[model samples]
Target: MSSTISRSLAGRKARRRRSRVHSLAIDGNDCMRQDNIVVEIPTSTARAATMTSSSDPIPSLGQHVDFRQRFEEEINTFATSLVHREPKYVPSHQEDALAMARIDSSCETAIDHWMLAQSFGCVKATDLTEGAIELCQLLVGVDGCEETRKVLETLSAHESVSPKNFLRGLCAGAITRWVYLDTKPQLPSVCQYPQSDVLRSVLAATPNIYRRLVDAMTLEYLERHFATTIPALSKELTKRLHTILTNFRGLKSANTLTDLSDHINNFRVWERYMADAFEGALRLRLNHLRSPMKYNYTFPSSGQPFVEDKMISLYSEASRRRPHQVWLCLSPLIESWNESMDSSSHVIISPARVISS
Candidate 1:
């Protein structure tokens, strides 16, 4: 009975020793016993082990996907808000038409001033008369009439018509006759697409893109519509001058002969000027295409009634008469075209400058 009690006491002592060792391992002490080996761990390492065991697990694949989706949703919402913002303002058709009219008027006025200042000023009536007399001497030689000389002398002395006015009138008349009567230009058929509300909205939203589009369109239109007819017109004018020179004596006055010489001289300067002017006008016209508007010019025919709104009388007498027919159109009327919800619309920007009978 004593031996049995002693064995029971030993078993209890061994069990208690194992319990104490398990408790010490869980506490992560600086020194521990495992299988009778002493293991030493730093306080920091023990603390890190404890923390690593107790902390939350690493994020899962599903959680990562959810986070990405939320971020993308935020980005999409920002983009949608930007799209709904107020669009940039676009000019109305009427405003564009008026602006273009102003530009055209200003350009023409500048050109006229330049022509007067540069080419016309250099050629005096006396110089023209002398050139005509020389031409007559060359053409008629010994057969030249004394009457022709007297007519030229009289014309040079006549101060009633200023040289500037005379030259300008002559140039205007010749250009009008050539363009409208001799060789009228046939405008090429341009395939124009009307702008939809959506497209306009897009353009209005992005100003840089809109500008680039306009520039490209203008350039393309110019490339296709450049005035090839101008060279032909110039050639025709030269031929006409030659014909006029051949029939010099048939002229009503020696003023005609002097004017012819002035016209020839002016043509040399006008060649480059006309090309530049046409290009500029075409560019201006194309720039307003965003408004879906069309620009055109109307050349008045002879014997057409001279309405005040549609025609400007070059002669003081025609203005005084008030009710006169156009004898000649010095310049064409510029018109703008637009389409309404119901019908088409036409507005004249500038009137034709005319000589009336």
Candidate 2:
């Protein structure tokens, strides 16, 4: 309901066109008919008798027979049904938790906080420790005192932290910095590279890198929120996945966000790149097998939209890359998506893309 693209001019125009093409065609004059009622009455088999005991006179207590017998009969009927019924238990396996679309915590913060984080270069680091430390200092300075002995103490003990460890710890440190700097909580800067609006703009244009960042954030977001319904939650996860990664082209290379003529021409190129990454990732997903998600019977007639941006199928791209693990966890999703029998006879992906049968 609160979609950004959903609220766009193009979206509105499409909706208006749809409304015109599919309006109701009700006949103003209506016809009605009434049918005669045919009822059947059953013949009486026996006259029911209320038995009573004189000493304990069950009917004496109320108006009918003993309540005990009636209760027993009811219990017997319930037991009979129970004996004939199949037992059911909730399925043990559940779909992976998915995140809500666009509700990124960093995005939720006020503009000033984002600006402060940006100005501080919180987003600049490939690894977050240095950025975290600087932000810690800035936060302490903001409080007008440098009781940042806590940060100094904390920073001194990190002699052997890896880059991965650094980002997580850096995120934690940013929280600490925000706590020390102000009376309120703050967004961590580890998510940002180059820690500025400019860097963010650049990253947004680079579809591949931007997607990795979003995927990480999406996991973090999902950890904070899990949903049980498989398909509905899956749909939401799909949407979030798409939003987290974007096709980021260097904006300066182009002119504006709405450089329509260029975008129209280069749009397919964007989609193809994303599709290539996805297909590559699916190839990576070949070996490792986790337990199958209890194959959900209620899969939106398999018509559920793949409304998500998936990451590149890179097996830890780096100097010492583990090519074997690259893209291992992606194929099942793509395979499912590929075979989904949506009524449209087509399964569109990313709007700019489609995987049709």
Candidate 3:
């Protein structure tokens, strides 16, 4: 019985030692002790075991959920920071004024080229003058009146005022009247708005922004304005043209009553072209400006001394070298002011094209 009890005790002790060895293997120590002997784990075996434990598969969907949560948290934090930030610096009016000074020369050149092309394609000189004269006669209800004859004589006497130039001058005058005089009252009062001061400062700082705003506003205004004025433009222009032709020199007319008139007619093909060109050019000019700027076209009268700074001669370089007077304005000068009422801030975008005598 004693021998059996001693064997059982020895077996229990061996089992405990084996258990300790198994625990050490599970823990993956590089070296372990068993029965006072150091046992080293094989390098390859230890590496494999380490890789096996680390290579446990994580579900792709779980990883995606965790990534999405982190991303959303970051975005929210960024948005909150922006919301709590202070106001950014607003540009000063003086800065805006400087921006306005930097004109777009390319756009100005393009406008000049476009105007020349359109004018070149206009109605023949004789046809346009004849139609204009006929239209003028019909409107005045007389044929070859003293005023008409005198105006024609005056125009003829000026060697530089050719029939073509006469007609062109009328067209130019008509555009000036239509834009500056006739439509002035109807234009929207941009300055009257509550936020106009803020708007002005902002727009001044960025001229391009003002230009875009002006373009959009002008587009909207033109759509409404043209709808009402297009049908009336031809007659209104004819009247104004006749007035310019007859009254530029302050000539008086004898209102002679004529017999029943057989002259009822619409504008001829070239007349229509003239009106369309006028509208297109006017639209282009109106859309070119920045907001809150006041603009006008300079229409120099006949016999005015030519100022080299304001007027460009259609004459050749050799012809322009001589002293001369402005015989007629082929195209009006375009000038603008930074402030609506401030004449001191005047800027000339384009010089007037003229014929010199």
lDDT of each prediction vs. the true structure?
0.46, 0.28, 0.49
- lDDT tens digits, residue span 1-357, model 2: 557766797788977864543331121121111122111111131123232342121111122466556654554443343222122332121211111011112222222232222222112222334433354343223221234444333332333222222222222233222221221212346445233453365365554444444434433333233212222433333332223222111123435655555554444343333333322222222110111211111101011233334322222334253222211111122221212444443322111111111
Q: Show model 3 residue runs off by greater than 4 Å.
A: 1-154, 185-268, 285-290, 316-320, 340-345
> What TM-score against the true fold does each predicted structure earn?
0.35, 0.19, 0.40
Candidate numbers sorted by TM-score from highest down: 3, 1, 2
Model 3 residue 39 CA deviation in Å: 75
RMSD of each: 19.8, 30.1, 19.6
Model 3 lDDT per residue over 1-357, tens place: 999999999999989977767655555435434445344354465456533343432322212356545644554443334222222333334543332222222223323432332222222223335445553333222466565454455644566655455555656655655553445425566585454674476466655554544444444555556534645664465455534343332212432343112111112333345445545544434343324566666677655788888878885325727636766666667666765567788777667777776
For each of the candidates, give the backbone clash count.
0, 18, 2
Q: Rank the candidates by lDDT, best first.
A: 3, 1, 2
lDDT value for model 1: 0.46
Tens digits of per-residue lDDT for model 1 on 265-285? Answer: 654544445434333443344
Best by lDDT: 3
lDDT of model 2 at residue 243?
32
For the record, the alpha-carbon RMSD of candidate 3 to the native fold, in angstroms, is 19.6
Clashing residue pairs for model 1: none
